[model samples]
Target chain A: MKKLVNNPVNVVEEMVEGYVRAHPDYIKQLQSNDRALVNARETKENKVGILIGGGSGHEPGFLGYVGEGMADGVAVGNIFASPSPDPILEVTKAIDKGAGVVYLYGNYAGDVMNFGMAAEMADLEEDIKVGMALATDDVASAPKEEKDKRRGIAGEFFIYKAAGAAADFGYDLEEVVRIAKKANQNTRSMGVGTSPCYLPQTGEPSFEIGDNEMEIGLGHHGEPGIEKGPLETADKIADRLVNDILADIEITKGEEVAVLVNGLGSTPKMDLYIVYRRVEQILSERGIKIYRSYVGDYITSLEMGGCSVTLMKLDKELTDTIDHPVNCPMFVQK
Target chain B: MKKLVNNPVNVVEEMVEGYVRAHPDYIKQLQSNDRALVNARETKENKVGILIGGGSGHEPGFLGYVGEGMADGVAVGNIFASPSPDPILEVTKAIDKGAGVVYLYGNYAGDVMNFGMAAEMADLEEDIKVGMALATDDVASAPKEEKDKRRGIAGEFFIYKAAGAAADFGYDLEEVVRIAKKANQNTRSMGVGTSPCYLPQTGEPSFEIGDNEMEIGLGHHGEPGIEKGPLETADKIADRLVNDILADIEITKGEEVAVLVNGLGSTPKMDLYIVYRRVEQILSERGIKIYRSYVGDYITSLEMGGCSVTLMKLDKELTDTIDHPVNCPMFVQK
Candidate 1:
């Protein structure tokens, strides 16, 4: 209930307005469909278009990622709600340069359906080639065999970066989609939720937990996780997350990886770095090499208290392009 | 009390350990004084050294701002307490290359005493010339006549940036100190606190407030504010902050300024953007041009729930040097 928002209903509209105005040099919202934020440096180049989005609560995620050398467009939605196909189509049409567009987003049902419909619309009505890829890297959401059923969390940032880099390298729509799939396949994430975030509209806690308890493996939107227990130390939590992620993927000794120790909204950066310290120790002990490190809030549930660890096993191409220059509002790698 | 830490008493020690290890490429802890984090890309150049530091709780503040084209060294301390003179002297000696060094930090009593003692020590022992600048940009802490009494808060980030750029451009220690002083004078900041943050060692809220109330003009460490009132809408709060800042400074029409809508840890970036939206509208109506914008968590007080707005009026020197390339772990510009 302590959200600092005006008119809970218009948070999305106001957020978009503020975002574009603040980062006016790199981003702008569509005049007709304000929810669709596109690159301010939009050019009719031959590169394939990269479009990414989801709900609005995850700031610096979809909107902040639309800039030079980053995702070209984003179709933002209401807090924790997927955008309809209208804005998706608008972004698709805006970013397309006859090289086709690829839709990438979390594996949520609403997003999948809406973005899929937008892809069909772009193909049938606009005559623009469209492809799709879903990020399914949250290992806690499903079993290894049912990986496609898993939800996307902070790992989606890596997937988007890989896809964007491929497109920036002049890859075709199909190749970009292929890279997105490969990045998704290589990425794994697990998060712990210490507390729930209250929604501005309802002014109610998304869920409840005991004062000293935390949910392990919870989804971004408070979906039930694997277990609930008294919160352990940062080292223990980092150990659990790293162990779960390693078990979900085939990454082994001597393999290099890109690491993301992401804040789940309210956790302190100190806490995330402490967790990263332990993660590095764990990885080093296992003979795994961490090629790059990111430790901060990338994607988040509104004011939710927790952290998530993501790792993307890097190949030759990914390692060379991992530092792909991006100047987005949220995730910038320069 | 919901901090994701291991040992409460060892929070600072672990934090430094984690920070250095996580960013080994850009930062490394001093072997002699582990609390001192120095730029990993150190060189024996003759340019004046830009050093920054303070208490530990403000992640990405003193520590994260050390890298190429940024500050050279940081004298880190425990949460909410200033560092001793030993680490200060250590950093001063490490970064100083014949050209001497400049010390810039928040205008806090403990910091002044400690850094002052270290400055004397460096002059007497190592014969390394040293100049100092204090960031006094928290307009809420004092009247214009007693500006030196104000705390640094988020506005100090701009001071550090200006000083670092001044040094990088091969300015002498005296000139760097002058630029830092000017940057501090031109900056102003105001923040609101919805809830208090708990210290890791104490495991208790630093201050208390009603669930439906917020303290406007509160300091970073839950210090007293100008007023306490019912939590108002984001727009109303933004208006109050902007009006107060404008009244404090004489920013005329057609002036250019940089804006920072910073989250105080737990406040969502969504709310910060909403606040920035209003901030932008007000500045536009006043005919002030926004030269650049930064919206996210920069200098945070652990997981305190609130946000702060900062403005730095730009002159020819500041405007040109504002985007000076920096690649620090926390703050980056390209």
Candidate 2:
């Protein structure tokens, strides 16, 4: 595959540099380091800081949300790789205000281990208060009893928005962490892939699927899904994803929920919305009140052909936070 | 190729519906019609309404900017097809706050003609003043003397931001139109493609290229590009795109500009930022001031494998407006 890059090893560093340079008005590098934080021109005065960190490949996740009313700081790792404890510590310290920092990130094992270490470092070295919330939304990774074993997917949006809002509303670290955990617990997601993505350094797919077949519950790293089957219609595919997710989460009738129909990477908006239409209709038929919906490529798996659906049961607080005004290059809500 | 759509003809309409539903806080349908408008709660407050429209396939164009401090309404057409005059008229009427409306759209012939008709209709029937500006940024299309022949590509973002700011500053229809036209004139874009995207309805690619080859100056609709050659590095590709755009527009040293490194659907963020790194280096070496930079799949061509670079020479007003705060689902600036 043809790629626009210098040395493969430099791709991640170069990308982080360029991204920070582009959005300097909203983001800044952490004291000569690769870690970044939202400019936070007005953040220091009003609330606790919200921190999110993850691998670099998920563009909008770890970086795109670093702006007003979202994450205060984002520690980026290498492409699909975890950031070391140093950068995480740097980010944690940079965004730390007097109140404390809430560390929210996807539930990858590397991220969990690294962020945990960074939290310890922050508490010991900087005398900063910090708490962590793990996103475990992908239902295909584990049964409901093993929810913590599931991998995180697009549902990280809910955790960030809720936690960010809680912090914005002057919640302390414990309160902010509680809200984030609640959001993560109520969120559920499942994904299916028609193809795999080629990692930039290797130039080979992490996993593979047949041209005419799709694998359900695929991880972002191109790991195999729960099952493989011939390509199906939008409705059938939506059922597979939605059924798996709904079965795992206990969303009651008339319960308000926020739905995110996310394109993995290469899926077109047309197909993504088609899947959303079916998913919406099914939810409506079940008397679920969709508080809001998000349909786009928010979280992606490079150029893989697939999408995931994330449903978050919402209360007034979660809804208000999700609707909070934000201004970032990749996402905005007014 | 496998697709998830219910019907090809319904793809655009269904997608628009899904978008509106997802962003009801910011966008709404034009009185049950296909067109959409930002829910300007204070429409009676006499703000100059900004309206943009075009075909549907370009995901973030037209629809993505409908929010605070951006476009007030968007009239969408079928996929890669222009919207008829009625929908444009509807959007214009819905957004008209008795302070005049600025019609901003791409330079496609159909859009120009349709929006022109709608502007006339609005003037005659609603006593709402209207002015139009066309975005013509594709460098390969034509030269300055023949500016009307140039195609509009990803550089439309500059025009949108400028127009939105002008409207926010309470510029009349004529003044807003003039400024928007100036922004378009100062902007130029060039794109290259490694693959063509298949239209959902046709289930066939709109164009063709060899596996080991790429085409430059490709349109968003899978139209033929200017040149075909062997695949090259992202840096080499960025050099070609930036050099062609800068040369065509005659961007001189020390001039401030905004850069957009846009991915055409299937390209990954890592690759897009890699290109941006090279692009920034080239511009910096030339002593050009990059006031702003955007990197992502803003204006996509379905799932085509490619990227485009857009450069807009920025005046102070344009720069301020491009940097202004905006709130929408797809774009946020804070």
Against the true structure, whose TM-score is highest?
A: 1
| For candidate 1, the TM-score of chain A alone relative to the native chain A | 0.98
lDDT of 2: 0.82
Q: What is the TM-score of each candidate against the true structure?
A: 0.99, 0.93
Model 1 residue A272 lDDT score: 89
Q: How many angstroms is residue A306 displaced in model 2 relative to the true structure, after the best TM-score fit?
A: 1.3
Off by over 4 Å in 1: none
**Clash total of candidate 1:** 0
Query: Which lDDT tens digits does candidate 1 get at residues B167-269?
Result: 9899888888888898888999989899888999878897889989999999988889999999999989999888888988889999999998888889999
- Report the lDDT tens digits of candidate 2 across residue range B1-334: 7677766778877777767666667777766575555554545447788888888878777688787778888888888888888888888787888888888888888988999999889999888888888888888777657878888889888888898888888877778888899999888899998988887777788788887898988888877778999988888898999988776777778999989999988788878887888899899999999988889877887788889999989887788788777776677766
Clashing pairs in 2: A3-B234, A4-B234, A5-B234, A327-B332, A328-B332
Please identify model 2 stretches exceeding 4 Å from their true place: A31-49, A98-100, A123-129, B35-49, B97-100, B120-129
